[model samples]
Target: MRHTLTLFVTLTVFWLLNSGHNTVLMTLLGLVSIIFVLYVAHKMDVVDHESQPVHLSLKFPGYFLWLLKELVLANISVVKSIWLGNSTISPCLMTIKSSQKTDLGIVIYANSITITPGTVSVDLIGDRITVHSLFKENIEFLKAGEMDRRVTELES
Candidate 1:
């Protein structure tokens, strides 16, 4: 029931933000659309009730701050590497163990790794993630397991 409500509210907000109109008719249409889509989704069984993990709403702010800091640091590292005279690029492929108990948590971890500049998650097999690193330094960062730890903390 909570997931259904969340889906409805999210779709309505997205429709309103993208529609760029403030008419009652359009608002009513958006609400109807949300309800219809969610109903169809529920019938299709695409949204598994068990897969949606309950999260601490208060932890999101801290997680966002941490992700922002990592993004900044990664940007700086990439820029420094570009400026460095030597071509220190050492491509490495490695498998990292994912500690996330839920599929959503694993998806978050993989997406976060891909979002960072130097690393890309090529494949996810069970609890193992295959990552390709642009440089040797990036490989070290992945091996440190900080990303997995942070994402798990957020998904809690």
Candidate 2:
């Protein structure tokens, strides 16, 4: 029930922010859209813990900020490598261990790796995520598991 209400409120706020119109007709239309989305989501049975993720709500903002910082640093590295030439981009594939206990945490960790420039989470099996990195240095950074540790923090 709490998750459902949270979803509804989040959807409404998202709609209002994106629409930018507060007229009665616009509000009604937005409400209708929110209801339809909520119905479909409920029918699909995707409103459970993994999907709703209320437990991680408070911690997500901090994680997001950290991700943003990592993303910027990665972008700089990629750009520098590009400027240095294609020879500087040494691609490699390797698997890194994930310590997260929950599916959501694992997914978040894998996605964080993917979202950061110069790395892609190719496959996740058991506690390992196979990653393709654009540079050898990126693989080394991933192997350090700082991002994995940060995401695991969100789970608990």
Candidate 3:
């Protein structure tokens, strides 16, 4: 029930912010659309913990800020490697251990690795993620476990 309400409120707010119209007709239409979406989502059975993720709501903002910073740093590193040419780049594939206990946390960690400019998560089997990286340092960074730790924290 809580997840359903959260989804509805989030959808309504998202609609209002994107639409940028407050007229009665527009509001009514938005409500109708949101209700339809909520109904469909409920019927699809995706409104539960993994999909809605209300449990992670409070911690996600901080994690997002950290991820944004990491993305910028990664972009810089990739650009620097490009400028330095092929000789400076070291391509490697490696497997990293993830400490996340939940599916959502594991997915988040793998997706995070993929999104960071220099790395791609190629596979996930159980607690291990196979990642490919343009630079050996990127793999070293993953081996250091900061991102994995943060994602594990998200699960808690």
Q: Give me the runs in candidate 2 sitting further than 4 Å from their true place.
A: none
lDDT order of candidates, top first: 3, 2, 1
Poorly placed runs, candidate 1 (over 4 Å)? 48-56, 83-86
Error of 2 at 139 (Å): 1.2
Q: On residues 54-140, what C-alpha lDDT tens digit does candidate 3 reach at each position?
A: 888899999999999999999998999899899999999999999998899999999999999999999999999999999999999
Best by lDDT: 3
Highest TM-score, which number?
3
Tens-digit lDDT track for model 1 on 1-156? 787766666678889899998899988888888888888989987655443333545686787788788888888877787788458667789998999987888888898888888889999999999999888888788888888898888877
Counted clashes in each candidate structure: 0, 0, 0
**In model 2, what are the clashing residue pairs, if there are any?**
none
**Each model's lDDT:** 0.81, 0.91, 0.94
Q: What lDDT is reached at residue 143 by model 3?
A: 99
> How far off is residue 29 in model 3, in Å?
1.7
Question: What's the lDDT for residue 2 in model 1?
Answer: 83
RMSD of each: 2.4, 1.6, 1.3
Candidate 1, residue 155: the lDDT equals 77
Cα distance off (Å), candidate 3, residue 25: 2.1
TM-score against native, each model: 0.84, 0.90, 0.93
Task: Report the error of model 3 at residue 50, Å.
Answer: 1.1
